[model samples]
Target: MSTEGRSAEPVSATSALESAGFVRLVARADGDGLAASGLIASALAELETPFQVTVGRTIAERSARVDPPTNEDDRTIVVGAADAAADTDDVIRLPATDRPATLEAVDLVREIGGTPDPVLALAGVVAGGSEPGAGESEWLLETAIERGLLEQRPGVAVPTSDPIDGVAHSTRLRAPWSGDLDATREALSDAVDGDSDALDADDHRAIGSLVALDAVGADEATDATAESIGRLLRPYATPDHAFATLGGFADVLEALARTEPGTGTALAMGHDVRETALEAWREHGRRAHAALSSASTGRYDGLFVVDVDDGPVETIATIVAASRSPEPVVLAIGHAEAALATREADSLGATVDGVARELAGAEPETEPAFEDGSEIGVEYDVGHRRSYLRYDPDLDNSTIIAAVREFR
Candidate 1:
């Protein structure tokens, strides 16, 4: 695997500020946060980018108060004190007086890289044909982990959760996605009813995610149905586990959405899934973007953030598609890295890029449609940071659907 670092010429703190699009300062209503905010504001002012500090109880609350940047000269940075980082989206701690947090913000957006073709690199790793250097491997692995396809163990990698065990009445451990949804659903229902309380954490997480997936994929599902499944999960799952499980289920919906047109409208699964996931995030008192940023199990390469500000939807789509879907696609929107990265599907990334181009070129549609019988057509929403696609089983979108059906 290629171990090349970003080839783009890195910019300096000054340039980063001049081009700053939005700046948000998030601090706790405490002394430390106030001090950090004062320091950060001074630092940004030196760089000619004025920063205003605000004290809030939570990042979501602060982010809600922040207006979008007015122009290219404007930017937003959230400086969370001791524990303020938990709620804020783009956050930094006061590292040292000599090395203020504001400078870190500059560095985040300044050092742009020529991210390797993540698709190709991931393909190589999956094929076992090439070994990526430490840096590349970290990116690929982290990307995969982010997608919920892999989890980091003490010294090895394992599937994030266990597979479906007994479909009906048997007792066996298998991938949850292994069999037909009917059998899997029945098995989960029985298990939960029988004695979910007796199951171990691993079993609970595995079953919970799969059950959630079944809820989303079912022909007839409602808000109540979704909530019930969530309640079943709540008794045994943490916010992170809930997030991961919903993400795993999202992968199922993404696959169905691609192969089955009109599915989005028929089940309105996209809206439901998105709402449910967001609900989970809120119930746990976590901001979706902040939670996603910290969700990485391992972080070797450091963090990167970008301001997409009025960027093309196709560009955003390319970035989202770069993430292996079916898992909840938690994009730190405007937080740019490699636009096309994956684990097993090297070509999937490239294919998504092509699909993104088609999406960008076509008239934006809120409704879904079969696009040239390939993938479903849907529009990308920047603020929502999501794309909703419909699945029409009647449509003969097999050619393109076949291309991505094997991704999982």
Candidate 2:
């Protein structure tokens, strides 16, 4: 309803205002009286409310004042929705973070009646698609629910479990080991692979994250984009693994897909990564064991794990060609080679792989389409992508970075 950045959750409109007792409404007006009137009518129709819509030929002629409320309890609390301002009679005013569901915030207040419950408030906002999650609205709301400020709806109630917030940035994000996304990702990888020493900067002065990003396999060539469950661990890593038995790798990848490391723009994808390994383990441990055991017992083809770095794309092409699996080979690369490796993976029809300590560039498209003057180059029989990149220690890191950037 409002794009003031106060729109509700990325989830569905249903989750944001899932309560039956809640009824949401919205209204807007601009210089064009006809357009404004149409929008009001549309909103009312969409919401299935009893309100009627009427349009006037001019600003003064268009409408009349609605009667004021009789009591304080009925007085409206006008919040600035995202970036807009409304009069006192208008119930909810959100600025930049307002959405149609933000109107549900009125319903939220009515539900809890000034109980200071973040959960109900968040639920109201989540009903729309506003807010950049400066705070975990859902968790904050759930916390409020735990505090007994709001009551959960029957059947519509959220779980009472303590779900993982995935990753959070403290004020000291760059202050060294502050538990920022980078450190969180590296911690997960380290915890999984038994390399807790990853990202060694315990102080995290620059990042101030609890997890040290440097301890992981980091290099200067690649930018320090902490990649965690949602850019939670290594600042630059793609979704590949986590600290515990991965229930589904997509959750980690899905979270990473939500936003870029530096820009924080939500990349369109399915589902949000909010739970930790322990919570997942408790929630679906039985299913995981059964699936893993089943996979292990199956007859599978050869598995080839390729680690590539700053080298010519031609070298990686050779390795992909040699892999036995019908499924393309996987390229696990370091941070410096990320850009080039991503290009190379695309050209080779392979997927990228990574943990928090490093960046892995992958894409399942190996067929390189050459330009008019492009040359078909492939190095001699190479055993692995990593070896080819390392074949020349004389190569400077900058060159590796450039190669990664231009690999595809």
Listed per model in order, the count of residue pairs whose N, CA or C atoms clash below 3 Å is: 32, 92
Encode model 2's per-residue lDDT on 1-408: one tens digit a residue: 111222333233333222222222322211111112222223333444333332211111111222243443232222222222223432332221123323343334333322222422332232121221334345554554466544322110112111111222211012122224344455444232334223233311233232334322233111222321122232211122222211122222212211221110111111133344224322232222222222211111322222333222322222232221123332323222221112121222121111211122222234332243322221111111211221122234444333333432
The alpha-carbon lDDT assigned to residue 375 of candidate 2 equals 26
Model-by-model lDDT, in order? 0.32, 0.25
**Top-lDDT structure, candidate number:** 1
Residue 264: error of model 2 in Å?
Answer: 16
What is the per-residue lDDT of model 1 for residues 38-134, given as tens digits with 9 covering 90 to 100?
4444445555565555554322334454454566455444433222223222222322112222223333323332222222233222212123223
Worst 10 residues of 1 by lDDT: 166-175
Point out where model 2 deviates above 4 Å. Answer: 1-108, 111-188, 194-408
lDDT of 1: 0.32
Tell me how far the alpha carbon of residue 280 in candidate 1 is from the true structure, in angstroms, after superposition: 9.6
Clashes of 1: 32
